[model samples]
Target: MLLKSITPRESEKIIKIDRFVFTTFANIEALEYELSLGIKKIEAINTNYYLKIGGNEERIAFEAKIYLEYLEHFSGLVEKIKAREPLSLSTLESTKIRKILIDSFSAKTKDWLLDSSRNATYYTKEFSIGGVVL
Candidate 1:
């Protein structure tokens, strides 16, 4: 399945965990340097985890699914970088390099959009939750 079912509460927790993972990666100076090299592909690696986006929610087995995905993607990227592989856009961008770049940007963008839209300041006011009027 493309999306996993998660309660709103569980989804919130996953989001927090995702933020921490992103922070760790963003703190890497080499990552910034690599990003500047350019994106070879816009698509990203497929993730097993997903947050409920305004739809039917399901129970999550654990909160670590997202973490595991982050670890998998990060490990792959590190391996490619360590092997002296190119991590940038090029007419001849290798499959490995393209996969890494795509996964990195996809995760980053997903977290950004989730965090940006999760402002408590706006939610503090009267509004609906899970599409149901409060």
Candidate 2:
């Protein structure tokens, strides 16, 4: 141990601590920062990525992705969901509820895709009282 190089175990532990990093944005600048950071990591280490491609679809896809990741990373989540318990505080914290509640920063690429797509807008059950689309 001449220079005391970081062990794979230590590096992995550090990565595990940041296994799920999230950044919310009030504007495009904030989103850009996260994008840059995420891009940098791809070269430094092989990593799983969850880049929300657009603002409109952010809410639509956010919860499902986070939930899937949550289920994959922690078996306790699966057990809790199976047991039919009220979501735990920690689990609630882990969910992507902000996307459902907030208007996230719009990405140009996402905006373009949504604009070009025939059915771009999210369809929330909360949006309609009846069959009428809101």
Off by over 4 Å in 2: 1-62, 66-72, 90-134
Lowest lDDT 10-residue stretch of candidate 1? 125-134
lDDT of 1 by residue, 43-84 (tens): 447734433334432111111223222343334533443454
* TM-scores for all predictions: 0.18, 0.18
* Candidate 2 residue lDDT tens string, 20-119: 2222211111111111222222233566655544333211112221222122243343333344333312112243222122222221212222445575
Candidate 1 lDDT for residue 57: 24
Q: What is the lDDT of residue 62 in candidate 2?
A: 28
lDDT leader: 1
Q: How accurate is candidate 1 locally (lDDT)?
A: 0.25
- lDDT for each candidate structure: 0.25, 0.23
